[model samples]
Target: MELFADRAEAGALLAERLPDARDPVVLALPRGGVAVAVPVARRFGAPLDVLVTRKIGYPPQPELGVGAIAEGGEPVFDLALLHRLGLTPESVAGVVEEERRELARRVRAYRGERALPPLEGREVIVVDDGLATGGTARAALRAVAAAKPARVTLAVPVGARGTVEALRQEADEVVALLTPVDFRAVGQWYEHFEQLSDEDVLDLLGAA
Candidate 1:
């Protein structure tokens, strides 16, 4: 399978598919997505912003997300997974509280008091580095939907083929460079899959 050298390369490739992206504001899911989004924003001559969302991970396996929480207290969960795992309502609530704290921290760190740009009547392009199960992306799409934008599109460099198709039901348009049937992890498609530090997120947000 092919791999991207870094997010700039991914963004450049994504830009070619978004010819209608002109004048559309770009909102990036931070930490990793910021790297992939900057080039797209630059290419489209659009303002850049951050959209903060946190995953509600399973208690035992913190990296395995069962759901996600977006800004404004909205939470989306994988009910089937929760039932299969026999997770209690209390357990899910606890996870939500923990993720909420992290979400609040990220919002303050990324945006401070800068209100999220009004998406009403505006074309908004949501960018992320990649999609796996797409729990977080679904949460973001819900948040964006609440804003009543003129249009909502999701752009990612790579995704699992099934996940990309699932996302199509939520987003008005979905643009991805690669959709691998044998997808393993988001990092597998990136040669430099470094963990973006908090400083990296801050720097990218500042640059935008």
Candidate 2:
């Protein structure tokens, strides 16, 4: 079954299950998650903000995320994976630098001069299109937690069971619409899972 037609549709459907929050704010992982977050923010009539995180992928295998970095937070490494890959801070410094540069560009593009909304003592809902390794999500959660939110809910339309379970430890609450054991990839659950560009992200934020 097609769980979602697209990110927008997924966001709308996911909004139905979210609790009616007080003093809530929606923070989205930019590029794709922004699409999934727009409706959720609208559903609660809450303020929307961007929570940017960049994946630190393995060298020569850019798709394999070994760690992630969020703005204003230290890089969160998968120590076990790093050991297995024989990667160290010195080894991945180049990749981290590359991702950091891209992350900065994205922050500028999506946020521009607007300031990040205050998260302290607020009900923060972090929305993403889906969770795979959960590396980026983990980094984002840690960054948000450092700001001392009253509560943090990690919300997603779908995710692998193991990844979702691991995320529960980082978040105050975990809300995933689909936790299929047979999960292969996030895009597999959606009929239209197109990659989101920087312009797309900015457009969504602008409309919100």
Candidate 3:
């Protein structure tokens, strides 16, 4: 069975399982996560903001994420992947720097002048459309943890069971609507998974 028809539908379903927080701050990973996060923030009556993160991929294999960097935080590398791929920080420095620029550009585009919402001692729900490798989510969770949130919950519409289980170590809680054994890609769970643009993200945030 298809778990969600679209990002908004997934957000609504997820909102039902999320608890009411005393001081809630909903952080979404753009540009797709914003759609899945809108209704979730509305459900909790909380402020929503972007938690920007960029994946650092190998020079030849761009699809393979070796590390990820989040705003105001250092790059978090997958040490095993680095070892397996025979890579090091020096080799990926250029990629990290490149993604840093893109990350900054996205932050500026999605949120022009508004400062990031206060995460200190607040219940933070990090929403993403889905988890594939857990690289980006790991970076985001660590970045939020550094900000000293009271609790960090990783919420997604669907994810690989292993990825969800592994992320539980970094997050205070993990809420996944579907952890199908046959999970291949996040888009597989959604009937419509179109790529979201910067304007799309802004529109969603504006509506929220």
- Whichever of 1 and 3 has more lDDT, that candidate is 3
Query: Can you write out model 3's per-residue Cα lDDT over 1-208, one digit (the tens) per residue?
Result: 6668899999999999987677689999998899999999999889999989999988898988899999978899999999998898888899999999999999899888777988898899999999988999999999999999899999998999999999999999999989989989999898899999888998898999
TM-score of 1: 0.96
lDDT of 1 by residue, 51-162 (tens): 9999988988989889998886389888888888998656789889988999999899888988888888899999999999999999999999888888889999999999
Give the number of colliding residue pairs in candidate 3. Answer: 0
Best by TM-score: 3
Off by over 4 Å in 1: 88-90
Over the full model, what C-alpha lDDT does candidate 1 score relative to the true structure?
Answer: 0.88
Candidate lDDT scores, in order, read 0.88, 0.91, 0.92
The local distance difference test score of model 3 is 0.92
Task: Note the clash tally of each candidate.
Answer: 0, 0, 0
lDDT per residue as tens, model 2, 1-208: 5579999999999999898789799999987899999999999999888999999999888899999999867889998999999888778998989989988887888888666798899999999999989999999999999999999999999999999999999998999999998999999999999998888888898898
What TM-score goes with each of the models? Answer: 0.96, 0.96, 0.97
Query: How close is each model in CA RMSD to the real structure?
Result: 1.3, 1.1, 0.9
lDDT: worst 10-residue window of model 1:
16-25
